[model samples]
Target: MTRMNYQSARFLTSAPTLAQCPPDDGAEVAFAGRSNAGKSSAINTLTRQKALARTSRTPGRTQLINFFTLGDDTRRRLVDLPGYGYAKVPEAVKREWQRHLADYLRGRRALRGLVLVMDVRHPLTEFDQTLLGWADDQDMPVHILLTKADKLKSGAAKSALQQVRSRLREWEDLVTVQLFSSLKREGVDEACARLDAWLADPEPA
Candidate 1:
């Protein structure tokens, strides 16, 4: 286990402008996914704190990039990206959100990894493929979390994971994938374990 603490974390907001970001000293792990993909739930589960990321019954509630700081002011952060593929949001607003998201993803120097959450029932939408492609172009490590696994039986969950793996094999970008359910508390520790390993190592200078 990594000898670290997750203390004093909070949701900072829906978007990231130049003035609203945390200092860029430490590595950051960002979360990107479709709306209602259980991102808020996964984030809360990871931090072991309820309401830390503000779950919404409605998709597209998170319209901006939310940032959460972990383990003191040493600069480690968990970034929550705006949910894509939600049809209810205005086209203009979604476009703006996409612009900001792309700029951040392509340009941020402190970003170390991205945790892409997708619904297990409908994993790997077209938007997901584009996001994975963007990450691949940047040579970023991606960890996919198939959320809402509790909605299905073990057999179904296994099959779903295998399906995602097969789809990923077609992509030239190699991304690691896992299954999780916030309601069932499944794969939470394993997800944290992987993140801990990444965060424990210092970024190459």
Candidate 2:
């Protein structure tokens, strides 16, 4: 497999709807989670950049689908979906975001897989399950990142990992879960390896 130089990540564009997204030219992986679930921080850590995905103290700061290209290649892209399940947002706006997110997930041909981030202490929320179910229906692979693992003790963290792993047994073939910490940079290589596999083509030019 060709190693992706994630450090070469660069902001590409932000799209409000799927219609505005870049051309569906090559494989792309999407990062998604509820608001304040450490999705942004995980992206930054994976790319080895401080502000690549724009972490915010306030939840629901990412209101658009932000795209980033790897190594000056427009074909290999990473998408940051808007953080969902934030209570402060208006009901109408929330409904619209849900529609857009669903459409993107269901219809985007270039989307190869999803990286779902969840807080280690609070894994598998209703929203997370909803997204996971959608991926399963589409036969899309998902990698769950239990972010903020550093906040828990070593034994507790291990327990949390085991619990989530066991819960994911039903979809073991399509889903994989791992403990990750943006602060400590845990599981970076594993996460990258998964992404590399997803983005790799069986027949290369």
Candidate 3:
């Protein structure tokens, strides 16, 4: 199969619940991360389109599972899951989002893999570990992007990358980590390459 031109990605639909998502017909990869972790910026940068995922100054602005299709094929999709760990949101609302997120991650058969974004300055928080554990339980592959790499100095950024890579050694075969700076457009190709690999496969094994 030819490499997908993510630049041709277009917004598909936003589903508040897994039941409302598009039919589970094709391979899909979901992007997940903590609130204000640069998930939106990384997605926009990956697709080479500004505002594709709706970046916002406020954390937790993405409150739904937003889908984007590559080219015109509905089978291939990139899902933007709601950002977690934003304390400002009400407890009831947060619980509801968490329930929906858990259900989708555990039940979505078409979900081929996951892209977990995190800030380089603060990688692997408690919530991140929880998600990783869940992925492990499902035998799902994950590619972690240490977003906002520009915020740290070169040495610090390298150290952060190595640290995360070292800590994830047990899951090395199923997990990959890379430093990414959406503002600098760094690591966009690498990130997309992983996404393409997942999408190319009929199902993640």
What is the lDDT of every predicted structure here?
A: 0.80, 0.91, 0.91
Q: Which stretches of candidate 2 lie over 4 Å from their true place?
A: 202-205
Per-residue lDDT tens digits for candidate 1, residues 1-205, read: 5744544566544455634666665777888988879888898888888988777788887776788777454467788888888848788988887777778888788888889999999999988888888888898888999999999999999999998898888553658899999998899877887777667754643
lDDT of model 3, residue 39:
91
The sequence of per-residue lDDT tens digits that candidate 3 reaches over residues 1-205 is 4588899999999999999999987899999999888999999999999989987788896789999998798889999999999748899998888889888999999999999999999999998998998899999999999999999998999999999999999999999999999989889888988988889965444
- Tell me the lDDT of model 1 at 38: 89
Measured against the true structure, the TM-scores of the candidates, in listed sequence, are 0.90, 0.96, 0.96
Task: Name every residue pair that clashes in candidate 2.
Answer: none
List candidate 3 segments past 4 Å from native.
202-205
Poorest lDDT segment (10 consecutive residues) of candidate 2: 196-205
Separately for all candidates shown, the number of backbone clashes (residues 3 or more apart, or on different chains) is 2, 0, 0
In candidate 2, what are the lDDT values of residues 1-205, reduced to their tens digit? 9988889999999999999999977889999998888999999999999999998888996789999999778888899999989648798998888889888999888888999999999999988998998999899899999999999999999999999999989999999999999999999999999999988852222
lDDT of 3: 0.91
Report how far off residue 158 is in candidate 1 (Å).
0.3
